[model samples]
Target: MSLSVARRTVTTPILLGLLLVAFALLALVVGSKPFNQTIIDIFLKVIFVVGLWVFIGNSGVISFGHTAFACLGGYIAAWTTIKPMLKGTAMPGLPDWLMGMEIPFWASAVLAAGWAALWALIFGAVLMRLSGIAASIATFAMLAMVNSIYSNWESVTAATSSVVGIPIVRSIWPYLIAALIAVFAAWAYGISRHGLALRAARDEPTAAAASGIDIPRARLIAFVISGAIMGMGGALYAHSIGIVTPDTFYLGLAFITLSMLVVGGMGSLSGAVLGVLILSSLIQILRWLEAGIEIGTTTFALPGGVQEIALGAVMILILMFRPAGIMGNRDLSLPRGAASDSQGQTGPKT
Candidate 1:
């Protein structure tokens, strides 16, 4: 890359990091305990959305299966971090080694991520062979299979019942750090040769293959990387709520995360982060309104579930006007010139 391009590349991630830290600090200062929880939720969502972007944004493949990785990660945390007595009783079928082990949360998170990535590699090896809608369907099927197994595995997973006793980390600093790590990781991959090649294939597969890019390998790499991220997010999410269940990482979450990614602009890292922050802020506001917030002693309240309806309508309107997303694949860049693009300029360049 040229010096200017390289500088832009480095500066983009730095700007994003600063933005996230600023938000973290703002929440710490201004938010009460409940509000802080909301902030933590947003940070976790940031990780999940960015994880999705790593593959879907670059490879142009939509995956409904990523949540399986999250479910795996959450269970890993449950198996590794929960008290041995509770784990043994709740999941008696677990092997002695797994049933007896109770490690620190951080270590379990790492192991969870590694476990998720392993499965991603195995599944991606097979699923990455297919393309377009076939790949999408295969991924959805994989998700269904995982959900079925987790939901029915009563001995180990406790079936659909909630597993409790996860160590809660309510502090925002750890979550903030994880969110920053995810952003940097995504930025690093996006500018890597593999990421570039993958995007090229996404736009023009035949040309990229003609140029000797191994599309399947590139997709698999992205898939594994994204799975690791989703796994980490899941582990943190389990700790955040102090519980785990199959439904926690199922279709409802998949739709919500995918919507945030799509509504923000799936083609860019900024979109991934911004989508979560923006949509999360809207949801928090709606929740407050639903709880009857008072302004000048006149309480205002929205009906239950109006938040989802309103959010859906807003997403529809945004897609209608800006189908590409609010950012539309543009990187967050510092202003350097009066004009950046000349596609629709009516007069001569300044």
Candidate 2:
């Protein structure tokens, strides 16, 4: 790479790191709840949004069913930390092997993500084979399928009611570490040749195939990787909530995740993180506005839907003005000639 591109690769991450630290500290300080818990929540959100960017943002394949992966992760992870004898507290059916098979927090987490990735492999194969509206339709269908399974599969997760006593413990430190790993994983992938090929395939499938790239393989790989990451995020969220239900994943969460990616800049990792922070804060502000706060001389009176309305307006405005996203496919602003020597020049400039 040239000096300028090289500099950006080095310095841009440093700046992002600083920003993460700043935001994390801010998260740690917010609300009356323990700072650690709040920080953990934000960090998990970071993981979810950033992980989604790996596929949805880069490959330009919008998925509306990622919540399935999240739900799978949460349910499986619940099995690890939850003591089976808790009876109704654990998932029903309780296969004899799982009835007493409670593992450590992290181990269960790994298994949960593995299961999610396996599902992604199967579903992503079919979905990745499609394009544009067809692919989107398949993904939406996947979400519906996953939702039905989660809701009706009582044998495993306690039916439609609560899956209780998950024994989830949330803290700032673990999530902070997870967030760092997630960001680095996304950055490394984006900077690699495989990612380059995927992006190429996304922009022009016929040309990419003519150039010997296996478009399906690239999309599948990206899909699996992204699903696994989202699973990890779900595990974290499950542990945070201590208990959950299938309904948890179906309440507009998929839309929220997609919106975050769109608002943040579907083209770049920073945009993913930025979009989450901006939108999450917006929600908090709206909540505070709707519930009049005691501020010395004034009380704010905002409508209840202010948060939703504001987010919707912002999303519309962003899409209308810069459809590519805030970063517009630029990972980071390059300094002069950073990429002096780069591969895949034949690929369209992103």
Candidate 3:
């Protein structure tokens, strides 16, 4: 690659990483435990949304099942981090070796990624065969199936009950590091040959297939990579709160992450990061309002559920005005616009 092209290649991730670092510094300056936690939440959302972007942005496939991978990862954290005696009491059906295994939070996160990736490969092998709405439906079905199994497998999963005693990681640095890793990973994959082929298959399916690109194979690669990222995010999420439950990684998380992707621009990696940051900030503001702010003598507060309502309204407004999302398929690049390294485009058609 030419020097300018190489410069462009690294610029996007560097910009995104700097943004995350800025947030971490802001949280440190604020020093409020609540604000720090909110920043951590934003980092986790960044990880999840970016993970979604790796596959959906490149392949143009909307997946409702990615959170199921998160669910798997969350349980992995619960199984591996909790004390052995606690695991035996809460999940008697765990294999003896698994029940006895106790690892650190970081180790559990690594294991979670591998576990989630394995399932992604298994599901993607079949699901990637379908396209359009058929594939979307298949993914949703996969989510539902996973949810059902986890909800009922009482011995292994504790069924619908919450599993507690996870090692809570209150530090912001870990989350910041994980989010940066996620950003770089997505940026790297977007420029890879597989990513290029997947986008080709997405934009010109018949032509790409005619040229000998295996669309399913390319998509499956993205699926597994994305699944691994989501898994690690899920594991970190559990550590963030010191608990895990089947419902925690279900539809709510799936929708919120997807909304971030859509609102930021589905085709741009920069959009994914911006979506989470923007919406998460708005949510925090609404939450503060709900908790009531004291202004001189009187206290003002919005309704309890205004955050959710506001989020829905904001999404509607963005969709109406900026149908392509806030970024609109553009990466956040340096001033020189001639060399744009957007994940949405793989340079001019040769």
Candidate 4:
């Protein structure tokens, strides 16, 4: 890597890390329990969005199926971490080994991520063969298949019923660490040779192939890496809420995550993280308004569900005004007089 690139690799994450820590501390000190949970939710969203950035941003392939990995991870965490007695009572059909074993939440999370990545590797091996809309459709199909199975396989997944008794983790520290780990991992990958090669394929597939870039292989690697992160986030999510349901990782989540990525500038890691932060902050603010604000003799409140409406309108406006997103595919870095690199027409500007 060039010196500038090396500096960015170190500085970019430091900058984003400071931002995340600042907000985390602010939420801890200034917010109530519910508000703190909101912060945790935002941190998890960061993990999810950054995971999406690793694959979608780098490979230039929109994946509608990543949430399936999250679903898998969430259930795995639930299955492995919940008390053995509870598991036996709640999911009697589980294999004897699974029903008899329970591990700490952290270990379960790691296992969950591993399981999810294994599936990603298996699925990506097949799905990565196609490109453009074909690839996207295949991924969506994969998502539908997973969702349908999870929604109906009552024996293991509890089907549409929410699986309860997954330990609730109300602390912010674990989520903070997970989010930072995801950010740094993304940064490391974005600057790696494989990440650069994948972006090259994304921008100019024919030229990239001519130059001997293994497009599908590079994409599969990214897919697996991103899937691991998504799995971690999903595991964390289940712990946060103390429940796992098939619908929890379905279209609504997919839409919200994709919107954050698209609105933040899908081509940049900074955009991915910032997009979640900015949009989540907006949603929180609108929700607060919906809850009602008082001024002297009057109480003001937005109509119910107005937060979603306003958020959608705001996203549309932002897209209209700045199509590349708030960050516009640029890496976050300190200004170096006469030494800075130009933002290029590619994802992960390494």
Residue-pair clashes per prediction, in order, are 0, 4, 0, 0
Query: Model 4: per-residue lDDT, tens digit, 237-335?
Result: 999999989999999888899999988988788899899999999999998899999998999998998988888897898889999888876768877
Write model 2 residue lDDT over 182-280, tens digit each, in one string: 777776666676788898887778898999999888988888888888888788788888877887876477888788888878877778877777787
Task: Identify the runs in model 3 with alpha carbons over 4 angstroms from their true place.
Answer: 1-6, 337-339
The residue-level lDDT of candidate 4 at 266 comes to: 87
Winner of 1 and 3 under lDDT? 3
Q: Kindly list the per-residue Cα lDDT of model 3 for residues 124-163, writing each as its tens digit.
A: 9999999999998899999999999999999999999989
Q: For candidate 1, write residues 105-172 as lDDT tens digits.
A: 88887998899999999999999999999999999998899899999999999999999999999999
Candidate 4 ranges with C-alpha deviation above 4 Å? 1-4, 342-350
Q: Which candidate achieves the best TM-score against the true structure?
A: 3
Q: What is the C-alpha lDDT of each candidate?
A: 0.88, 0.75, 0.93, 0.88
Each model's TM-score, in the order given?
A: 0.94, 0.90, 0.97, 0.96
Candidate rank order under lDDT: 3, 4, 1, 2
By TM-score, the candidates rank as 3, 4, 1, 2
lDDT against true structure, model 1:
0.88
Name every residue pair that clashes in candidate 2: 2-340, 4-338, 5-338, 154-159
C-alpha lDDT (0 to 100) for residue 32 of candidate 2: 46
At residue 83, give the lDDT of candidate 4. 90
